[model samples]
Target: MTITVSNLQPIIAILAGILILIAPRLLNYIVAVYLIVVGLIGLGVLRHFS
Candidate 1:
């Protein structure tokens, strides 16, 4: 199986939804981390490592 940028968003959203449902208090941290990760990926910082 292969993963691509186009396919990552929904997977991340689903996971985030589940996490928020399980622990509402973690919403802030989860969103912050998700944004940071997405930003890094967008900037191609993570592509090199992968």
Candidate 2:
């Protein structure tokens, strides 16, 4: 099973949703980190790692 760029966002969203539901206190940090990581990925900074 391969994960493409198209599959990344929804997966992240779903996971974030679950995390937020389980721990409301983590909502802020989770969203901030998620945005940062998504931005980095979009900008190709994390391309090499993938």
Candidate 3:
């Protein structure tokens, strides 16, 4: 199975927003991991999406 970039981008943005809003303390870690993972996925460095 695979997930398209267009499909996952918005959801990732929304989840990041919610997490930042609901738990300010986790913003750093959440954003860091999100950026790292998304960067890899976007760059085609990894292909685990499904």
Number of the top candidate by TM-score? Answer: 1
lDDT comparison, 1 vs 2, better candidate: 1
lDDT of 2 by residue, 1-50 (tens): 77776777788789989989999999999989978877898898999534
Cα lDDT, all candidates: 0.85, 0.83, 0.82
Residue-level lDDT of model 3, residues 1-50, one tens digit each, is 56677788898889988988999898899888978887887787787662
**CA RMSD (A), model 3:** 2.8
List pairs with backbone clashes in candidate 2. Answer: none
Better of 2 and 3 by TM-score: 2
* Model 1: lowest-lDDT 10 consecutive positions: 41-50
Candidate 1: RMSD to truth: 2.0
Per-residue error at 21 for model 3, in Å? 0.9
Q: Write the per-residue lDDT of candidate 1 for residues 1-50, one digit (tens) a residue.
A: 67776777788899999999999999999999988887997888999523
Which candidate number would show the highest lDDT if scored against the true structure? 1
* RMSD, one per candidate, in order: 2.0, 1.9, 2.8
Q: Against the true structure, candidate 3 has what lDDT?
A: 0.82
Using TM-score as the yardstick, the better of models 1 and 3 is 1
TM-score head-to-head 1 vs 2, winner: 1
Candidate structures ordered by TM-score, highest first: 1, 2, 3
Ten contiguous residues minimizing lDDT sum, candidate 2: 1-10
TM-score against truth, every candidate? 0.78, 0.73, 0.67
Sort the candidates on lDDT, descending order.
1, 2, 3
